[model samples]
Target chain A: MRASRPGMSRALVRRETIAGYLFLLPSLFFFLVFVIYPMFMCIYTSFFDSNMGKDAVDMFIGLGNYKELFQDKIFLGALKNTAIIVLVSVPTVCAFSLWVSSAIYNMKPVFTSAFRCIFYLPVVTGSVAVTVVWKWMYNNYYGIFNYLGKSVGLIDSNINWLGDPKYALWCIILILFTTSVGQPIVLYVSALGNVDQTLVEAAEVDGATKTQVFWKIKWAQIMPTTLYILIITTINSFQCFALIQLLTSGGPSHSTDTVMYYIYYTAFKLYRYGYGNAMGVVLMVIIAILSAIQYKLGQTDS
Target chain B: MTTKKSALYKIIAFVLVLILALLFTFPLYWILTGSFKTQKEINSTSPAWWPSEWTMKNYENLMGKMKAPLWEVSVPFSQYFTEDGTATVVSAGPQVPGAIRWMLNTIWMAVAAMLLTCLTSALAGYALAKKRFIGRTLIFTLIVCAMALPKQVILIPLIREMSSLKLYNTISAVIYPIVGWPFGVFLIKQFAEGIPGEIIEAARIDGAGEVKTFTTVAYPMIKPGVGALAIFTFINSWNDYFMQLIMLSSTKNLTISLGIAKMQAENSTDYGLIMAGAAFAAVPIITVFLIFQKYFTKGITMGAVKG
Candidate 1:
């Protein structure tokens, strides 16, 4: 009986393993077809120069695409633009998101719940309609903002909002910052919920003020979420494209031309699939490196 | 003394929160009011802070303009023109039929994509979460890695592939890529972990098959998760413009975003009509959010908490 029992258990384990693989088949298949194959194809196609013209032959160019990218001023401009947005926006947004989240965490349930909903509405409402409305409101000559500013004596006259090369990128940055409350807010709130109530009460008993409690106890407890928000915000800031296209299509002089946008423009508009793929490879490397560094930092911090 | 200090802090916090709240709320208020105002009123040098006459003219004009499309099947083509030699652009009323058709197309595509995503994610997530097998960790790692690869990197190859398959300019082309999302499976798997193993085990011991247990116990436990996933998947598919724009070349297959964009670009100066279309496009999503706010919160909270 004991020998039979051991054999039966092994059979059951084998059956379970088979069943698990069976369940995983569909996802694995799709991933292979849709993700893995395409990724390989992207790399493969990058070596051959492509033109939209039917008569042209695809010339095999070894590292020629990469070499051309070094000299491509448009590609370099996009790289610079992406870096500027990420460097300027991520830190400020992360700080504000954390602070606002903490403040809301302290408020009463009714008030805080309403605030959460209002803030998250933007995530669902990032439509061209909203963008258009904002564009109208940011109008240089007749904008509500300019009108209000003049009424309050903050400016002498209409400040061209989306027209100027300098202001165009900044305008996009401001809009993006405002619309991106969903992830950071949700992270802070969830992290706040997991905080040990006992520790908080003990700190209170020791007469720790709210600020001190937040900085000393709550912040430290929520470090993982903070780190997560920082990494995601950094990754996201690097991928800004839609609003740039809508509000200003890489602007008066391609000042707002982000790397991803440049890739899209290059591949679709310019019909240089090989060159675009080379840029894609570079972008992937940058993202991978940044993610690795963030992971290391997170491991150390923890 | 402590009471007085606490009171002071409370006052400061209240003022700060109120200011922030007002700042956020003001733009929405401005837009809502702007929607009500006439173009002349909206463009006036000293714009009216509030509509003095309070005409429903904007809504009326939008609705009247929007009607020509629905009636196009009944109305003769020549009836669209006026008696004068001049072309009456307003008589035809700006292709409202096309806009309605695009809205339907968008909704249908989103529904199909969401259904496909849910089926695959649920099964895959359940397997990953509950079953112990070799290569499970590797699969999890791959999914995470896939999340890091932005859609831009893949669009070129995907477009090329779609064109080769003759699926370019079709709704299926837009939705097929979205159905295979790694994020959906990751999210569903995370939620599935919260389900106790005992229930599944009990069901199995009670002579219920694996598929049966999945249908009954596992499905009920993950119903909230399914709801959350549906909303998110729908929204993502609906709002996605870049992929659809590249894949869809024909007007017949254009989704709402692409359609509206085309309209605006083609008729560059038709501000009123474009606003109307934008308003129409925004309604479905806003309604969905309001109705399913709790699910959205749950999905977002769960995803963020895990991250």
Candidate 2:
């Protein structure tokens, strides 16, 4: 492009740009096929009365699926179940992680690293493996929990934790809660690391109690991380499926169903593509609204 | 001045954390010992905290079964026929060989997906951060929005499309969707934003092409972020269960996570065997993170630097 003559130099520049586009092509292709295209297809298919068995889509039935979703008892139950799980699990994990993070932060460096690795071990553990281990632990007979309960005199006899509807949701929630503590803890630790040491030292010099120093200084500094963890955890709980599907399959009368699990069954097992798409659209909306609120809240905290 | 009081508080905090840390570590400890104990030992009247008899029988049996050729042997127990005409088979437990195959499949898929995600994210992130190109803000915004879109919402259509393209039940089905991931791109973009523009301009002025400048000057600067993205992507891919289960239906095609789920559905009460499989499966990921714990921690902190 250094040539004063425009034609050949312009062609060379155009060729370079084309090469840049080529470098971008593979990434763009996958994103379009997998993410963007699928999203639009999901929205578009929600308008049609389609089932998976048939190759061709049925007649367009705009808003029918959405209308039916309102009346679908299972769908409603799933939404309620998801809400309960998110409400219960996210705060529990966040609080627990924050507590542990502060604890780790206060520890000596070598011990802190050791404790961090131990805590983060679960996050690195494959979900299936953890679920299986937990499932075995939750067994009525030959299970560690029941065995422990009997040994501790907590119960006279074994209780089927996974089979009982009343306790099944709790089982799944506890598994999720325990396994997810690592992420928020990591975030909190990083957040705690960034707290201004001088401010904390000044507070200490001012004769403020440790609790006051933590509450007034360290906690406020970690607000942004807290907000991030809250939003991500909420999103995660709403979409919690793999463990539930493997452990319960929304079982003992759908007491443990989350909205994401419902959508999975609807599309894959029930073959109700249209209905599944509708539920997905609703989920997307909820996630978007919640996440946007969190973003705003995060900015304000910053 | 108040060192004594602070020391007391520190002691309390230490004790509190030590308790929580042990609680956090209990599951892993259980699995570790449970794996070493025999089925009878595991199911005793009073469960042993440590294995009374640390036998290699389970591992030997599992490894022997896994070494079977063709990777599938008709679920072994049923096929172990008596010398007589009668087939005296009872339970068809999980094929250890099959589980090993599945784990390998998961590892390969995760590795491929991790490489693709890191490469694409780094380049795209570099472009977004360093380039003053047209539509830059729009691309960055799109990636941020993508980070918020749950995979569940997009999974159905993605699967349908995969089946149509004949990618179902293959590793490609799991790996392709994760390539060029927007979340990692967003993460890397944030990290790359800290790269001083002068470095790139200086390299370019010194006769380096744009690609040269990116690889030589820009890439090394964002090494920590790239490392973070790789660890994150690998962990996420390794632990992913939904996509693996939905995409790969056959036992032979299962991942470690899916294999564990299958074991759960089938075995139900074999705590020793289940724990054995779990410990074996989880060890690889944990070992990887531990070996690279420093990098993993640094990478994680860098990724969360913005959030």
Candidate 3:
């Protein structure tokens, strides 16, 4: 009887293994063919001098495209712009969403969810719609910003919000900020709820002020959430493509060019497939490194 | 004194959040009102906070831009290599408004993506979460790493892959990539972990087959996760503009957002027409989101717990 039980259990394990793989087959098929293949092609094609012309041929000039990427002034400027975007937006998005979530998460449930819904409106509105509306709002002659500014005596003249090299990138960043906060706010609210209530009350009774509690106990508890938010927001900002594409098209003298936009411009517009893929590879490395660091920090915390 | 001060601070925070919410929603508010505003009002230096005269001219202009059939009936996935000059065809259907056609295309794409993502993710996530199998940790780790990487990084190659598969310029090109994304699976796995193994063991001991047990036992338990994934995938794939822009070009195939973008590009400063297009694209999705807001929120939160 004991031998039969052991053999039968082993057969069950085998059955589980078979069923597990069968369940995984469909998802794995799509993942392998679509994601894994392209990821490989992205790296492989980066080494060749490829173009979109039917008559042309791909020439393997290993490291050549990578070499040109560093020297390309427009690309370097775009890198700077992308860097600026990541630096400015990640911290601000994390801070802003955290602040809004903290403020409303403790409110009446109706009011809390209402506010959450409202803040998420822009994201739900979709980028093309939101971008066009913002484009109108930033119009030099008829913009609400200029009108409101003049009415409030904040400025003497209508500033070309999307036209000027100075303000173009900032305007794109502003739109990105509005759309990006929705997910983080959603995430933060849940994270706040998940924080242990008893620990928070203990801190309060032990004479920790609200600010101290937020900075110490609550903050420590939500570090993983914060880290997760940080990495996601970082990825989001790095891929700021739509707003730039619609609003400025990398704008007045390429001042608003992000690496993502530049990649689109190069590969699709200019037909420099190899060069664009090289840029893609670089971007992937940079993001992977940043995420790795954040992930490791998150790992060490626990 | 402390209580009073804290109450004042609470009030201040409430007011700030309210104001910020308004500011954030202002663009959508503008799109809604601008679509109904007069041309003169749209161009006026002093912007109209409210439309002075409401009219349907924008929608009229938008609808009149290009004429396509109101709806078309065709075989799903009938695309194949035709020897007769690309004549591998599906049966065609009636004439439709170009705008409504775009809406249909967008709806079809989003729904297909949602259904596929939920089905595939549920099965895979259940296996990963419940069934002890070799390479489970490795696969999960790979999914997490891939999810961290932005989807756009592989754009160049995806275009090539889609073209090679004869899916370029078709809805399938857009749908497959979104389905292929592993975030949905990761999310479902998180939710699926809550399923008790004892139930599955009991079902198996009760003589239920594997497929039968899964369909009857695992599926119902994971329905909420699937719901969240459905809503999330729908909203996201609806707004997946970049992929659509590259993949689908024919007027009839353009998603509503792409159609709006095309109209805006052609008539850059024609705010009224553009707003009408914007309104068409934004309002429906927003309505869907509002209706399923809880599922959407659950979709966002489910993946990040203690991560």
Candidate 4:
């Protein structure tokens, strides 16, 4: 009986090994073929001077794409635009959503959910649909913004929101702000709900002011959610592609040229696959660094 | 005094939220109403808050512009079909409105992606959570790292890869990449971890085989996670315009978002027609979203908490 018991346990372990591998097979097939292979090729192809069509052979031009990217004026401008967007959108999205969540999370469940759905509508509306509508709304000749501005006496003359470089990036940022807030608000609401109410009541009983209670207790408790919101918003802002592509097409002298849009333009339009992949690599590195920095800051804050 | 001051602050906050809500709802509202507005009404400097004369002209123009087959089904290893006792070689079917075709394609793609992602992720997640398998931690770490990487960074290579696989210009190309994304796996794993090991051991003691134990015990426990992942995948795949734009080129295969994008590009100044297209794309997805909002919210929270 004792001898058979050891053998039986060994058999069971072997069966588990087989079963575990069987469960992982389907997902691993896709992950390997689509995700892992592409990721490898993205870095590998960046070293060559590659282009489209079968006749063209990729020439090894070690660091040539990266070298050219630094000197390319358009690429530099795109990088600047990307930084501006990430800088502007991340804080505003975090603050606005935090405020909105704090205000509404305490409301009745019906009202809270209704407001949540309304804000998320723009996101669920899909980027293409949202961009098309915004294109109409920013029309120079007949848009509600111009009409409203003229009526309210905010401006002396009608302004072209998207056609001018001065307002174009900001216009993209505004639409981005609307879409970015929904997820943060949802997260913030839940985080706020999870805060220790007993401690909050204790603080209140001890004559702590509202701001004091918020800044001292609730804020620290929700630091992790805030950090997550910051990282995601930064990433989303950095990758603001569909809006720029559909609304501006990186036009008006490339004022709205983000790294994402430029990458698309280079690969698809100009067929500079290697150069585009290099830009993509740089973008990934930047996002990784920023996320790490935010994580460090979050850890210190708590 | 504090009570009165708080009451006033609450009222002010309520008003602000109400106004913000209106602003947020305006674009979708505009899409719906503008779809019904005539060109003259659309171009008027004094925009109509609500349409005075609602018409279907925009939708009519949109439908008339493009035509495709209502449906096309391929039979494996068969070239001909019998209609009225005569062998007829298969060809493209009769023409239908392009918008309808786009809608159909979008729905089919989203549903396929959702089903595939849920199935694969659930099995993988159950293993990662419950099975004491070698390299489980390594696999989980790889998935997390990949999730952090922005998807667009890999698009150029993915395009080349898909072309090499002869999957370009096909909906499957779009669907496969989305399934390959590991967020669903991560999410389902989080939920699967909550399943008690005692129950699973009990099932094993009862002589249930591996697959049988999973189907009977693990699956029932992870059904909510699967539901969350399904709705999340469906909504995300439906809205994934960038991938659809890159992968699909043929008019008949265009998803609704891509169709609207092309329409807007061609008719840059035709707000009415664009709005009609946008409305068509937005309404169905929004309806799906409204119905499954609970599951979607749960998915987001669950993913974030574990993330």
Scored by DockQ, the top model is: 3
- For candidate 3, the TM-score is 0.95
Per-prediction TM-score = 0.88, 0.89, 0.95, 0.95
Q: Write the per-residue lDDT of candidate 2 for residues B223-264, one digit (tens) a residue.
A: 878888898888888987888877887666778777766665
Clashing pairs in 4: none
| Alpha carbon lDDT at B254, candidate 1 | 78
Error of 4 at B212 (Å): 1.2
- For every prediction, compared with the true complex, DockQ reads 0.42, 0.44, 0.59, 0.55
- Clashing residue pairs, backbone N/CA/C < 3 A, model 1: none
Score residue A195 of candidate 2 by CA lDDT.
95
Worst lDDT window (10 residues) for model 3 chain B? B81-90
lDDT, each prediction? 0.75, 0.78, 0.88, 0.89
Could you tell me which residue pairs clash in candidate 2?
Answer: B66-B97
lDDT by residue (tens digit), candidate 1, A169-237: 888888778767666886787788889889989999999987888888887898888888888888888
Residue range A1-302, candidate 3, lDDT tens digits = 02123334777767777888999989988887888888888899999999977688999999999999999999999999999999999999999999999999999999989999998888899999999999999999988999999999999999999999989989988999999999899988988988898998999999989999898888988888888889888998999999999998998989999999999999999999999999999999999999899889899985
C-alpha RMSD between model 1 and the true structure: 6.8
Instruction: Please give fnat for model 3.
Output: 0.79
Record all residue pairs in model 3 with backbone atoms less than 3 Å apart, i.e. clashing: B69-B95, B69-B96, B70-B95, B70-B96
Per-residue lDDT of B18-48 in model 4, one digit per residue for the tens? 8999999999999999999999999999899
Docking class of 4: medium
Docking class of 2: acceptable
Model 3 ranges off by over 4 Å: A1-14, B73-79, B83-90, B133-138
Query: Which 10-residue window in model 4 chain A sums to the lowest lDDT?
Result: A1-10
lDDT, candidate 3, B1-307, per-residue tens: 9899999999999999989988887888899999999999999999989998999999999988877766555544445545322324355556666788899999999999999998999999898888876677788888887887779978788998887676777787899888889988888887778889899889988999988988999999988888877887888899988889888988888899999998889999899999999999888998988988887888778656613
